[model samples]
Target: EAGVVQSPRYKIIEKKQPVAFWCNPISGHNTLYWYLQNLGQGPELLIRYENEEAVDDSQLPKDRFSAERLKGVDSTLKIQPAELGDSAVYLCASSLEGFSANEQFFGPGTRLTVL
Candidate 1:
């Protein structure tokens, strides 16, 4: 079975540039999540989706960050005019339905570097 897939494992851009990251969750998984991780810190949930509905997104920066889960399968995260402080890893994770206690499977995150 294929795990989650993410694009552009590494990205470099100047400050105030827009960057987008993509993710494809595992087949049969109904819960998906996006997280942001700073250097030397654990991942912080940015958004969570159960199917096409965004269940939680309070931590997401609405001013510059946006996310979407299309058809309950693939997802995209975008940061417009990214700041120098936005340099971090964007992680995508997925798990089974019914809020299973099993560990979530994470993708090889997209690392963004803002200069």
Candidate 2:
């Protein structure tokens, strides 16, 4: 019955330094997701995993961003050589299934600020 967990909760980095965020999904959930939310905007899916398989990651920025859910329970998102535009909330959410109508529970998020 544990909720999602994230680290640091906040970050400040220069424009070219790398940063990483972590997440642990709810127990017994099969679907995990990473989302990005710019200030004043809704979350946008960066990737989605269904039991260790990355079912959807079309929105992920391949050039400098990457993610993985090796055991399908925990996940990590990395932004290498970060950019000023990368400053935003990196949210992790989980659901029972990939297409479930149920609402996803979100983590507090790692707020990254680039200077």
lDDT score at residue 83, model 1, on the 0-100 scale: 99
**Number of clashing residue pairs in every model?**
0, 0
TM-scores vs. true structure, each candidate:
0.96, 0.96
Q: In candidate 2, what are the lDDT values of residues 1-115, reduced to their tens digit?
A: 6799998799999999999999999998899999999999999999999989999999999999999999779999999989999999999999887466878999999999999
- Tens-place lDDT digits, model 1, residues 1-115: 9999998899999999999999999999999999999999999999999999999999999999999998989999999989999999999999997655868999999999999
Worst 10 residues of 2 by lDDT: 94-103
Clashing pairs in 1: none
Which residue pairs overlap in candidate 2's backbone?
Answer: none
